[model samples]
Target: MKWRTLENTAKIFPATSGKKDERVFRFACVLKEGIRAELLQEALNKTLEEFPMFLCVLRKGLFWNYLEESKLRPIVREEYRTPCSAIYVRDQKNLLFEVTYYKTRINFETYHALTDGTGALNFLKMLVYQYLMLAYPEYVKGPVSKLGITSSTEEDMVEDGFSKYYGSGEIKEEIPRFKSYQFPYHRREHGRMKLIEGLVSSEKLLQKAREHNTTVTVLLTSVYLCAIAKDMSIRQKKKPVSLMIPVNLRNIFPSDSMRNFFGWIDIGYDFATRSNELEDVIAYTSDFFKRELTLKRIGARMDNLIQFEKNPLIRIVPLELKYIFMQLGAKFISVGENTAVFSNIGKINLPDDCESYLDYFEFYTTTPTMELCMCTFQEHMTLSFTSAFVTNRVEENFFSILKELNLDVRMIVSGDSRAGQEHFPDLSKETATHDFWYRLFTFSCLAVMVISNILNYLLIPEMFWSRYVMGGMASAWIITSVGYRKRRNLLKNAVWQLVLIGIGLYLWDYATGFYGWSLNIGLPCLILSCLAAITAIIIFFRLNSADYMIYMMITCLAGFLPLILNIAGIVQFKALAVICAGISFLTLAALCLFQWPAVKNELIKKFHV
Candidate 1:
């Protein structure tokens, strides 16, 4: 019954734009009269305190670990931290966060490695709406003050508590991850324009889409492709329009978990002919994309992931050694890593009651390097836009074109005279600093996991046994507390895991003959761990075991391998035993910590659905 926290053992791939490890994009909106930071912050504090998973930070050590959900976890709290001082809020605002409050003007930049534009922007809109509604509950049902923007999606109330579309069964599908190389993609065109956000009446938006014979996805993507074609002056390239689309995995997976659950789905096309109107482009783009995205393709990708993770060698590598392999693995799975990714989270589902309180919302996209990051989120009618560019001119050029198309939109540049300028300069510097920190952080963590694995070999026999008891005891926290997450509740299960771990560690410590431990104790540890993992997985995940056990086993062996190698001089370290113990802590203890929950209703609704 012991379980570890879900924070440790989780590896968050840093966001990247080209080779850079960090980049952020932000957009801002002024609220209707009467909304202030204090009111919004209080609302967010209450909401997030109820959902603690949103507060986690990256845990620093040798291996990848997440912070325990703690008081310091992020909230509507403003960190007057030097440079970009702002509030950090959660779930009710984004795909990642439903919403939280920020200054009237905000930059929504996050490392591209964390998630694509589609997820980030949805987060922004939700955050803004949540802030306004919480602060001004009486604004209800209309545009407010000088902004002329009205409550579009849900500027009003609380979530319906769960998805209205639940139980439709129309949502499930399989996605292939871990598979070997698919066709590597190449950009079809060259020129690039910043993605522009515009407001269109819901009726007009739909009508325009109908006339063009395209869904919003195809229309926007086609616009992007055209911009690229123009920029690169891509003449005579065969049918060359392509985009990386992020597919949400919630519908694919049986669980209704509202956490980070999604996969990348690719959509691309070559033109039948070059001469085409916007309408023609839309029709061609729409029709081509429909059949290409299917459940079969997703399942194939999932199979690919299994192939990679289940490989005996991969499974055997310890947590410390995963980086070397992961880097190699990442390159193998990419599809023209340069072809721009366009993610559309579509319209966010806001609370119906929220209209009485909120202002409109915005979605923004960012990356270290890309022709553009196109993101869109719909409130009742208009889609707010947040775009990133290699240069300012690109962004300005995009706006010019949209105006030519007669689309009415407002532009709020970061350093405008609007007084919110206080937030930008600092945020910019912070973004730059983070760019360096994130990459170094990843590389450092990998190095630590590797070193810790090496240290496990030089341990004292008695000390080794004690450490395993301590680590196992620490690891059993969540498995027991899940039913009643409290310190006292965890004590019972922690005791059991501790005893079992102590016995397992002791058996291997002195099995008499050197090979005897492998045959007797090591073998049993291997067997029991496998059984324990598999049964829990099947019972919990409700799907075929997805090579998780294989990896866990591999991590343990990998941790041990350094010590064996050090003895043979393949590696050299004085504390090989200590490093080996570290591996046990990371593999068993760290991973257990990762098995906690992110969403409340996801569990409730999942069981009912």
Candidate 2:
């Protein structure tokens, strides 16, 4: 299997992501006509052939979580699930992103650890272009070139920007921190979220920004700060209304990597001390942008973040324990310091010929409290608010402020629990039926024992035939339990079955007669069989030796036990036992001689304490 380490900023997402905070973002492109699932599936298949990095699955190592190459392929289906629902389930080997369609919209939702908004948008654009080429061959004829995308090599798509740009520079002074004000509203039950999208004229918004002599991002951010302040009470007004804004690092550094190449800055306004009017807020925001958006400030922060990944002590800590510390830091340091998140993805660009098939683009992200995301098409400027609060007052206040500026704002609202309730399958009913049948089978086995015992008591008292039935039932349960416990890992399952069955054979041999066949031949032969199975697995999967070394080590250690018993004169057989021990010793020696570093590294990570 091929694998790569998660970048510096991506390490925390897998740890801190949960039901309330899914850490998933969505990008959708609405076309002029309704969607066709077949053509869209073909488009996805073609898109994945070029972008293999998006097809990998998230796997956990001893020290870190990584992206491992998987054989699982994504299927494009009609949209039935809520937007930005969870896509990365721990221990499951599914793809990290999903593509679905709803009427005229093509939705692409991805796990944050895979890529950021910029990387995701590029992939989405290519997917749309491919679908267009296939759907309408007349208007958009392709010569195998990606339309509306900057040319980039496949290697550049997976490059780690943080590793490329970080250096051993002097650390700057830390920025001052404060506890930001949060919304004093009740949260919805069962992880429900509300999405509000407001569409307005892009040219009008740009003109409005020009009148204020600032960029569109700073102007909207000022309006958002004012919107958040509208809900603050007298006591809540003392703390600053802070928002965490994600900045694309590719703008500062020279790279075309499609992975997560982004950094964030926290911009806040003190409503209690400063003026709360729009013009005043705009002035303060424009100044903050000028000061924090410099290369010196961004570089200092980027270096500080990457420094933690380089620590020797931190690298040695196990992934499970590291996640605990990560979760704590997120709750106390990250969430406590920022009231909300805002990401401005700027614009969605396409070729002039391809733009005729598209209506507009929409973007949003999942959040525990709230998040506001902005993006623009040719004439449409979309400001989407994703909130977990029970009220929509923040979104209401946001667009209302824009409307006050004489901008024609159009609003579309969707809820988590309402959109797809009818589409969810009743999994609980199926589980209940399965449990009922399993319990009934066990009860029938007990009843058969009772009936057999009564028949023996009435007919033959000397022979105990019912005991055979009882033993058979016990063996059935043991087998089922073993199979159920290790179903996920096939290599481990094979080893465990060999051990358990070998012990059972020995017990049966002792009970029937003391022929010593279990120890002399049966156990040794089974050990050799396990060794062969492990060898087959490695060859079949074309796997790295380090990936399966732990299994190999266990089988080798078990192989010596039969020979040790024979040396102690406990087993009479010698040839098979000697062969098994000799083969195990030779394999271990070869591993230590040729692949020692990888084997040793695996051991250190597993037993780091």
Q: How accurate is candidate 2 locally (lDDT)?
A: 0.84
- The ten-residue window of minimal lDDT in model 1 covers 1-10
- lDDT by residue for model 2 (207-325), tens: 99999999999999999999999988978999999999999998888888888989988997899999989999999999999988877788878888888888889988989899999
The numbered model that scores best in TM-score is: 2
TM-score of each: 0.52, 0.77
Please list the C-alpha lDDT of all candidates, in the order they appear. 0.41, 0.84
Stretches of candidate 2 exceeding 4 Å from the true structure: 143-150, 168-170, 414-417, 420-609
Error of 2 at 496 (Å): 10
